[model samples]
Target chain A: MSEARLNTPISPFPSREQKQEERAARRAAVLRAAVRMFNARGFHATSLEDVATSLGISKPTIYHYLGNKDQVLLECVTIGLQQLLEAGAAARAGPGTGADRLQSFLRRYAEINMDDFGRCVIRTGEEALTPESVRRFRDLKREIDTAMRELIEEGVADGSIAPVDPRLLAFALAGALNWPARWHDPAGPQSPGELADLLVATLATGFLPR
Target chain B: MSEARLNTPISPFPSREQKQEERAARRAAVLRAAVRMFNARGFHATSLEDVATSLGISKPTIYHYLGNKDQVLLECVTIGLQQLLEAGAAARAGPGTGADRLQSFLRRYAEINMDDFGRCVIRTGEEALTPESVRRFRDLKREIDTAMRELIEEGVADGSIAPVDPRLLAFALAGALNWPARWHDPAGPQSPGELADLLVATLATGFLPR
Candidate 1:
């Protein structure tokens, strides 16, 4: 190589930060591809080979990035659950009445369920996971459930929400929100935000007129 | 043979009705066993052999009664859908305000989801069934949706229910009720009937105070 070429700021090889960013971007791409296929075809029906094929990469590359299929699934659901946990924490920490915070959290919760990773969380059954993974999945899910119940309890305590069984109410709300993952068509006219708002409105006001 | 035996009115062979009844009973037993196993282990993880073993019958016996695994799942979901349809019909035909009838159907809808056949319907995904069976399953589910929508429409027209999108409301109500199939414990202290009532009440009143 010429001295002038060597002295130039631009290098043929990627810097360490560039390499790390590229790796993170590639990992996210694989996860996105895997999660979408899993949601569309189901975990049992989808093969890692197909996910790799969709990404124009080799199966070994997927393994290098995300481990095995089970691990890919765990990662997807973990990301989704973490989003929910963060939403709950944000809502709790934000200003307004208890009901206001809960409503904000529920909207985000519904919207997340309609997204790629969150849809995977709702669509995946425990039977799809290895025993160890299933335990971890359940624990993460239980934390979200606890977070929801606490929101309900806070709302009830403040008298902003109706007096109801927090557990039952949480289940009802979660089920209503989780269902969009099953039935929502991304190609449909209604956007996830609109659908989430409508669902939350129905839950807040109920079937009965005020 | 004794002359008294020849003269007896009773025959050694079963009557045709007796044979029919026995066959029906056996088929029901097989279905019951299969649905329970499917709900517990999930449709993909469960096998006909395991179901047969649980009932002390052979796999062929299961096939003889319910065709194949996909067919068995189809039959199970069909039964559950039929129950929901019947509930809708009965509720519609009964004398009361539309809200009253809707609430009645909702309770039955929730209770049925906690039962064996209904739980199977909720747990068994479309991917688990054959393409043909998936079509049929979806058609039956659509019928139930139609029934629910009509009930809601009637309630809205009669001013018994708040003015809302019947389709969205049905989805919300069905989702809330459908979820118990995933989380409900038959062995738990709360009965299906009680849980159903609680869920229906939650949906009816919603989270906001009355």
Candidate 2:
């Protein structure tokens, strides 16, 4: 066989699954850059060109992978919410107690908010999205809120957490977790894990002396 | 003297101080409406025309009173921060321990986030602002953050609050307090004051059983 033909068989031409994996990885890279830019600059001020430029990818390549700015934002939020939902499920399924589960979930929640994808979820406003996108985003957000409230309720029922209004308590905790996305700097003195651990500890056990 | 001349002395065509008060009140009214709309529809989607229409005033009137859209947003944030600063000062000077002072300040902070001016401050991103305006806003926000940390430090020193990292604690508390601005609805089931009180209580005392 010719040298080129021999090399083709040697590389095996990358199976379809491998090709798909490569495509997914590229898409993920684009998303990471988009989220970082959107977090630094407001969604309204950021453009697809800026995201593409940051990644050294062409605008068409971005469109080919991410669709558009709105789509990119939607994907970012979707990924973040999915991660949160998964963490919630894990915490619920595997835990020492209700309070333990809630704290574990909350630590993950706070840590996520400090990441690029999580920050994008918090930073993207509904106004920037289409009505349908907004509705979907709201639904996902509601799911997360519900999961949090359910954890608190479980804790309360188990006598591990106080009988506080679950809805309000969830909002308070969620706010605290989400707020870091707006201000957390990766280059800051404290790492995301340290901040998350401190915050979760404060909530799980009151900051006031026992 | 004629009847008109005698009545003129009674009315006095409005004193300069009265006129000034009226102008100030009108300007405030314009700001109130603008902030509400900005908070509801976002600063970018909202137009002076929309605000003017909502307030039954002309666009030029909004311009005459509040300058451009950026100016209106800046003023809203400025007013909100000033109110917060004033509350911090009061809490610091008021009687009780550091915990009490911090709670008092946090209550006001949460309440402020629920109001139009306060919501505007939280909702407005600095990406839409000029460099000078962003600088001013950051300075003001930094002042508020410093005040919160100071209050927390005082509480720790006085043995009112637990020995925790004041910076992290402040971030956690501030995040919870500021979260209301993003979710609290005026027409919602609970009043802003009630919600603020409940949230502040949760953070101050925490939700775990004593």
Best candidate according to lDDT:
1
Model 1, residue B1: displacement in angstroms? 3.9
DockQ of 2: 0.77
Measured against the native two-chain assembly using Cα atoms, what DockQ does each of the candidate structures obtain, in the order listed? Answer: 0.83, 0.77
Candidate 2 residue pairs in clash (backbone atoms < 3 Å): none
lDDT tens digits, residues B23-122, model 2? 9999999898888888878888999999999888899998898899889889989999999999999999999999989989999999999988888888
Model 2 chain B: lowest-lDDT 10 consecutive positions: B4-13
Best by TM-score: 1
Fraction of true contacts retained by every candidate, in order, equals 0.73, 0.72
Return model 1's CA RMSD, one decimal.
1.3
lDDT, model 2, position B61: 91
- TM match of model 1 to true structure: 0.97
Tell me the spans in candidate 2 whose CA falls farther than 4 Å from its real position.
Answer: A1-8, A11-14, B5-7, B10-14
lDDT of 1 at A119: 94
lDDT (Cα, tens digit) per residue for candidate 1, span B49-70: 9999999889999888889888
lDDT of 2 at A12: 60
